[model samples]
Target: MSSLNFNLQEMMTVAASRMLAADDVCFVGIGLPSAAANLARLTHAENIKLIYESGTLDTKPKTLPLSIGDGELSDTALSVISVPEMFRYWLQGGKIRTGFLGAAQVDRFANINTTVIGPYDAPKVRLPGAGGAPLIASHCQRVLITLRHSKRAFVEQLDFITSVGFYEGGNSREELGLRGQGPVMVITDLGILEPDPISRELVLTHLHPGVSVEQVITATGWPLKIDADLKTTPAPTAEELYLLRELNARTQEAYAPDGLST
Candidate 1:
C-alpha cells in the first residue's frame, strides 16, 4: 500500500475517526460520520459506543448501516428503544458524549444549513431537512461536524439555518436556552477547524498532509481565520488506510454492490 494515498475522502474520514476515543459514547448519523465512527470502533477505539437516532444503542454494525433504521444496526445493537425514548433518555437527558453529524453548508461560527440551496420561498437544490440534527446539536455534550470543504459548502452565510452552531457567538446557545457545548471541531477534506476560545469562530488550525494553507483559504467562502500556531495533520498510516478500506469494502458489499466506495 502506498504511504501517500492522496484520496481526499479517505483522508478526511481517517482524520475524523481519530477524534474518537475509547471512552466516548457517540451519537452518529449517516454518511461520513457513520463511516468514521465505524472505523473508530473497528480499529483503535473499540470501546467507543455508537448510538443511532433510530433507537439503536451501542450499534456494532458489520457494515455501515444504510440508515438509522437499518436492521443490521439494530441486530448488532446492545439494546433498542423507541425514537422517543432514545431522544428523551439519551440525547435530551445529556448522556451522549458527542454528536457526530454532517452538514450541507457551514459558516465560521459552525452553523449548518441542510435545508435549501437558494432562497427559502423558492429554492434551487432542496436538501434533506433537519431530522434530529437540531435537537442533537442542542443537547449533546459536544458536537463534531463533518463535511466536504468547498467554497460552496463552506458559505459566508447559510440559506437556511438547519442547526445552530455558535449562533452569533459568545454564549448564544445558552442565551437561546439550548444545552450542550455547540460545535467544538469541524473535520473537512481540506483540514480541521476548531473554535477559537475567545471568539468562538472556526479557525483553520490544521491542514491535511500535502495540502497547502492557501488551498484551504481558497476553498472557504468566507475569509477564514488562521491559527498562529497551525498544525499539519499526519499522513494516514498503513494500518489506518488498511482498516478504512476493509470497512469500506464491507459497507459496499452490503449496501451498494453496483460499485460504491466509502
Candidate 2:
C-alpha cells in the first residue's frame, strides 16, 4: 500500500500536542487526547504528569492506554485511590493542572455537547453523555479541547450542554464562582482558537499552515469570529515531527507487538 495519509485525526493530535507544558498535570481522555498527551510526554515535555479518570495519579505508562481503566495506567502509576477521593481530593481539590478533552460539537461560547444531538428526552443522535467532563472542566487549572472543525461540529448552539465553557458569556465562569483556569485554548484541525477577552466567546486566532481564514469561516456552522491580526499556526518543526514519529513507533511496538513490526 501507498504511504498512509495523516488526515484530520493526525492533525488533531498535532494540535493537542502543542498545548501541553513541561510539567503539567493533565487529566487525559482516550483517543486523540491520549495520543497527544503521550506524544508530549515522550517528546518535549517528559515530566508532564498523566492522570486517568480511573483514579491513577501520576501515571507513566510506556505504552498508550486502551482506556481510562487500562491496566497499564494502574501498573505504572505512582499511586492509585478510590474514584471519590481521586475527584474530591485531587481534581476538585485543585491538584490537576489541565484537563484534555475532545468534543463532538462546540458552540461560540465553547459550551460542549457530548450528550446528544437533538432534544433531551427525545433525540436524533443520542451521544455518549458526559462521564467526567463536567468535573474535569470545572476543576482542572485549565482545559484544552481537540476537535475537527466543521460547520456541523462547530455549531451556533450545542444540542445539549455537557460541560460549561465560558458559561453564558463574558467572565461568567468567574462570576459564578467556579474555580479553575477555564478553557485557555481550543485546538482544531484547521486552526487554534481563544476566547475573546471581553465576550469570552471562541474566536479564531491562528490558522494552520495551508489553511485560510475563509476556509475556517466556511467550516464553522455559525458566524465565526476572527481577530484583526490572526496568525498562521507554525508548521511542525523537524524536531517536533521526528519526536512525534518516534513516540508513535514506540507506542505501536509496545501495544501491538504482534501486529506492528520494527
Candidate 3:
C-alpha cells in the first residue's frame, strides 16, 4: 500500500465534477454538491450555468457558499430572479440539464433523506428539511448525488424520502410521471455507484484509488451490488487538486471570523 497525494473527499469531489459538461445548465445544492459544481465550472466545465435555489442564475462564486442564500451567489450571478420564476421557469420548464444534490441518507434505490434521522414525529436528529430538492429531482434532465460513504449515510431505508430517486425502483419513477431521469451517478468517498438501467438499483461501478470492493460494501447499509464491468476511478490530477485546495482555502478565508475576503 502506498500513500496518495489527495484525500478521499477530494477524489470524490473531482469525480463528481467530471460528470458535468461545458454547456450544462446545472442546479446546485449546497455542501459537497456546490463544491463539486463550482470545481467543474472552474476547471473543465467553464461554461456551465449554475442555478442556485436562492434564485441566482449562472452564479460564479469566488468561494464555497455557506448556504443557498449566501450573498456571494446573488453578487456573482448573471441574473437574479424570484424563487417562483427560478423554479417554474428554469427548473420545471426543463431548462436544467443536471441537478447536483447532497443527502443525509440514501437507500439502494437512490431515494434520499434529509428530513429526520429517525421517526418523523419523534426524531433522534432533525435535519434541514427538503428545500428545492424534490422538484430538482423531478424536473431536471438528470440528477447527480455526492455524499460520503458510510453505513449511516448509505442506509437500507430512509427515515423520510425528501426526494424521489427510482422510488420503488425499475420503472417506478416513470410510472409516477417524473420527467427527469432519477439519480444516475452517486459519487462517494469510497467509489461511484450508478443506477442499473433495468433494475434501477444502485451498483458499485468504480472504486476510488486505494479503496476495495469489500470496503465499499462494508460501508453501505444494504446488500450493495457490484457492476459487472467495475472500474477504478482515476485519482485527482495535479491541476484538479490544486484548484480544489485553492477553492477551499478561499472559502475558509471568506467565512473567517473577521470578514469575507476581497
**Model 1, 1-262: lDDT tens per residue?**
2456658788899899999887799999899999999998977898899999999999898888877789898999999999999888888898898999999999889999999999988899999799999888989889999999999999997889899999987777678998888899999988999998867989999898878899999999999999999998887889999999998888788765455546
Instruction: For residues 9-82, write the lDDT of model 2, one tens digit per residue.
Output: 55567767978999888999887788899888877788999988898988887778767788888999999989
lDDT against true structure, model 3: 0.94
Q: Which candidate order results from sorting by lDDT in descending order?
A: 3, 1, 2
Q: Rate the local accuracy (lDDT) of all candidates.
A: 0.90, 0.84, 0.94
Summarize candidate 3's per-residue lDDT along 1-262 as a digit string, tens digits: 2578888989999999999988999999999999999999999999999999999999999999998889999999999999999889998899899999999999999999989998899999999899999999999989999999999999998889999999999998999999978899999999999999999999999999999999999999999999889999998999999999999999999877875559
lDDT, residue 240, model 3: 95
Task: Give the range where candidate 1 is weakest over 10 consecutive residues by summed lDDT.
Answer: 253-262
lDDT for 150 (candidate 3) = 98
- Where model 1 places Cα greater than 4 Å from the true spot, the runs are 1-3, 256-262
TM-score of each: 0.95, 0.90, 0.97
Clashing pairs in 1: none
